[model samples]
Target: MQVIPLKYGTIFKRAFGQPDVFCQFTKDILGIEINIDKVHTEYEYPEPIGFVRSKYDLFAEDTEKRIIVEIQQVKEDDFFDRFLYYHLISMVEQVGGYQAYGFDRTVYTIVVLTSTPRDGSINFSCAVSDMNPIDEYGRTFVVYPHRLVFLCPRQVNDKTPPLVKKWLNFIEDSLDGEMDEVDYPDTFWKKIMAAIQKQTINPALLSEIKDDAAWEEAKIRFVAEGVEKGLGKGREEGRAMLLKQQRETVLQAREMGLDEMAIAKLTGLTAQELKKITK
Candidate 1:
């Protein structure tokens, strides 16, 4: 009984897209609590004409702030650029008129990446900081509410917070189908496990997941085969080039009036081999 990867396409969306689960997850990652009623999952919004469609993993709006959660399985070069765009769009959608200036709400962006970032940090956070010349004077500076949090599961370690560490362990091993020894707070774990199990039991969904896994495996094998063939061809070409150089050396020695035995000795070729080349 193979378990579907929790980070893959639809399984990821279905597993964490539940209202209760996502809200709790938001709390765990950001250390902020929000009303469950405000959380919306798989929410779609209109994009510019002639552009691709847009959908969000989760959207939560409260009296003072709006939160957007994104789960990324694969890394992208323009990930931050796109995330800023989404943050801006979410802010734009909230205010319709110029008079709504002071009525703007704070926006928080959360991204969970299964792949580690290039800097090798386990967790990354960005915020609107107020720069000060020196902190020794105990001067306080105001910070903006626009913030971003990145969670990288690969880098989680003992230094991580207890709850978050346990949760990350659960997510990393979710595909193993062996949760009996998990030591997390049981209620939260059970809630999330139930959501995962619900989708895992669907026959059509399971088939699609299996097919995608097979395709990925086949693609990897195809790439490996191509690399192997390329190396073999390169080796053959190198051997052929060496042989051509050796033949040229033999001819050059013969042109210098060297005798058959002398040429054979100088070129390290047997008399019979030298005769074939000369003929």
Candidate 2:
């Protein structure tokens, strides 16, 4: 059946928004059993705590822990830093009133990268990060419950876990073209796939997919033109032209409702640089 790629923001949100699919996914990927009634998409902190805010792709919480799942189709230079901030912010938000700064619930962040990661050490299909402290005497402290997991579908191999591999394979296959129903025989997989079937997608989502495609094409064209213009000009001129293009792209992305952090990721601009450009 023709399946819409889950790499797209709208499609990803739609499929995983269902509680069962989300629970099944987290169970397989994180090996955690969680029962959740609602999944929040594009979730933001109700009150902005500081200058920066976080908007998560998928967020769910039970009594003991909060789960965040982010799907990043575009590779960001500060991918690790960005997600770390998101993880911490979720923990920090728990503190209220004059109470002690004790965290009531642990936070778990799962980042799924559809593209190959730029970091060499992240060659494996799955990597986990946590706050397990170790002493010089080979002693370990397992105090912190918070954890971060990175999943790169493109890096799947023989060593990858079978269930995790199947999930990743589904994501990778959908991006390529039509996905055979026979390949996803599991009831859970079939349910997830049905959520993103081409026939079920409404006209509004179809338009969004088209707009995303156009934006990607425009970025490619812009980069190509910038490179050609740079080759035809002096070093200083080329730098100036590139900077101009970057500023224009930032403004366009903002108009399209992309956050500053997202724009920085796509343009390789720093927060300060983005502020200056937008100002």
Every model's TM-score? 0.64, 0.78
**Regions more than 4 Å wrong, model 2:** 117-122, 227-279
- For all candidates, the clash counts are 0, 0
Candidate 1 residues lying further than 4 Å off, grouped into runs, are 1-3, 47-53, 100-103, 117-140, 181-185, 198-200, 207-279
- lDDT per residue for candidate 2 within 1-279, as digits (tens), equals 998887777888899889998898999988889978999999998998557978999999999979999988654478888888898899889887675888899899999888764557568888889988999998979999799998888889999999899888888888864889988788878888888899988999889987876886787689779878877787778788888898899989989999978998999989998888667
Query: Model 1, 158-260: lDDT tens per residue?
Result: 6677656665766777645545535545786776666566445588877766776677578668968998999999999998797787788888987898887
What TM-score would candidate 1 get against the native?
0.64
Q: Which ten residues in a row have the lowest lDDT in candidate 2?
A: 114-123
Among all candidates shown, the one with the greatest lDDT: 2
Report the error of model 1 at residue 242, Å.
12
Q: Candidate 1: worst 10 consecutive residues by lDDT?
A: 124-133
